[model samples]
Target: MAWHDRAPDSFTATLWDGIGDVWAEIRAHPFLTGLKDGTLDHRAFVFYVIQDAHYLREYARALAVCGARANDVAGIRMFCEHAAGAIAVERELHESFFADFGLSEADVAATPMAPTNVAYTSYLLSAAYGGSYAEAVGAVLPCYWIYAEVGRELLAAGSPDSRYQRWIDTYGGEEFAEVVSQVLDAADAVGPSLSEADRAAAAHRFTTTSRYEWMFWEMGLRRETWPV
Candidate 1:
């Protein structure tokens, strides 16, 4: 009856299914729902983009770390390419949005990390530095998997806002889906060999990051900032 009790052959599938409720919450979150409906505040969306630009810098570094630590050359190359591709996407996407939002290079550099952004990126960096290859992959998987899923869902439902539609199409497109598949395959490769304890640890990483994914949307909706 519990979520994780359902049998799945692949550990990645199992981990994903176990977090069904979390995914549901994400899909229904007002931030995302508003985006779908073209009702979300423009300022909030801009804030999300600015914070995401900040997050992607650290995320690329984390990917590079994972690539360096991978045992197989193919895994190393895949991760490294993903890392580079992530940066390239970040630059292109954010720059495209900058004129729309009147955001300059200095403005982006001056923006502080929101509380959730700090927490999410810090957790990922620590995981990459301290955890095994399996755990590192787990920690990073949700960003790819969740975004891809959300992108596809948004595309299907259709966004009235061109900006929102562009965001959705980028992740929902074939190229990004291929990247997500590669990451999933990489996780699957390392997962089977993990000890039970390590596997559980990896699942925990996946679940925690998934929660952060939800909080990230919430953070954007609120335009969250530190109180102190």
Candidate 2:
């Protein structure tokens, strides 16, 4: 059966489709286009990537917990596997990025979280602890899905043959595809049955999350700084 078929109902499918649509739109946004094409400044964007990498393990662990709560053995396995992959990728990517740019983990960690950064992490943790596995997936899809789309667009837009290629390659590659597919499938399994009010609440959460994603790119370009 198709991975999506494992989803219990159409509600879950709709949620995943909605999340994917949001991500695709973000990819095509001009703001992100400029950022990825190197038309924008680098410090904030670089800081975002490195600091965000530090949180991947937390994100993955939360997903695993949610999956287990839902009795989703496959979900648990997928999150665990994906987390392992993130560990290796994060190590390699961060080290390379620091070496290439003459930065360090302290630089990124000491940089206070941008509003967008905090929003992204907050939404994930909130959804993971307070929502279902499907909800958690919905909350997290923006990052992975948006990066993949942005990676493709950046490449098409003639992103240089530089270290940025690693960022593009990591997100645009087969590995990320699998991670996204699994996340979407998990979202597809959780039917969105909240009442109209509940749906409105959920939609609000998602929209806010999407908006924060844009803010993240903006922060990158602005080189927004904050206290540690």
Candidate 3:
């Protein structure tokens, strides 16, 4: 069977279809499994949240770059909203988790970026600065798409821990799903007009970022730190 058997006919869908193994790996990742069952360590969860806070700051900047480069008013406005929402709304979620986890602002600020976090955000920033609009969108899409999917899956399985449940509900709720849908719509609008080379680049960005998504979860599970 195809990876994205039910996916609609669009570049994002095609990119997703081509990355079956990566998606499966993400779904089966120990971090996600532990999260689903509420068996994950609190320290590990805290580490994940800290690293994610760092990631979101850079992600928001990349989104702003995308907005600045967008050709259409709607695309520009959509990306601007997304950029603001990432910082305003998602960062607020992180702040709430920080309080629950006993993580101070200084603690999060002092947290060094793991190798994987650095690589993932660097790739995104590079794409945003150097690639076309489609490529930028593709690079960022996996973050939203994967989290939304994982959130729904974990929520359905039911977390025994309220902390874990809160995290799950934030991403799994209808509001976040709508955000993902808006992003998908933006990608589809730009996809059909992309040149063949641009399309290929966008697919590569999508696939590469999807791998990073899995690595991100693994980084969290390990509470990854700089090896040096």
Best model per lDDT: 1
| Model 1 vs. true fold: TM | 0.95
What is residue 228's positional error in candidate 3, in angstroms? 1.3
> TM-score, each model?
0.95, 0.76, 0.95
**Which RMSD does model 3 reach against the true structure?**
2.6
RMSD of 2: 4.1
Candidate 3 lDDT, tens digit per residue, 77-147? 98899999999998999999999878799988988999999999999999999988888888998998888
Q: Give the C-alpha miss distance for residue 151 in model 2, angstroms.
A: 2.5
Positional deviation of residue 155's Cα in model 3 after best superposition, in angstroms: 1.8
Better of 1 and 2 by TM-score: 1
**How many angstroms is residue 96 displaced in model 1 relative to the true structure, after the best TM-score fit?**
0.6
lDDT ranking, best first: 1, 3, 2
Relative to the unseen true structure, what is the Cα RMSD of model 1? 3.5
Per-residue CA lDDT of model 1 for 1-228, tens digit only, reads: 112122368878888987999999999999999989999999999999999999999999999999999979998999899899888975799789988888898999999999999999999999999998888999999999999889888888889999988888898787788778888877877877989999999999999999999999999999999989
Global lDDT for candidate 2?
0.61
- Over 80-115, each residue of candidate 2 has an lDDT whose tens digit, in order, gives 666676667666787787877887777756766666
User: Which of the predicted structures, 2 or 3, would earn the higher lDDT when compared with the native?
Assistant: 3
- Clashing residue pairs found in predicted model 2: none
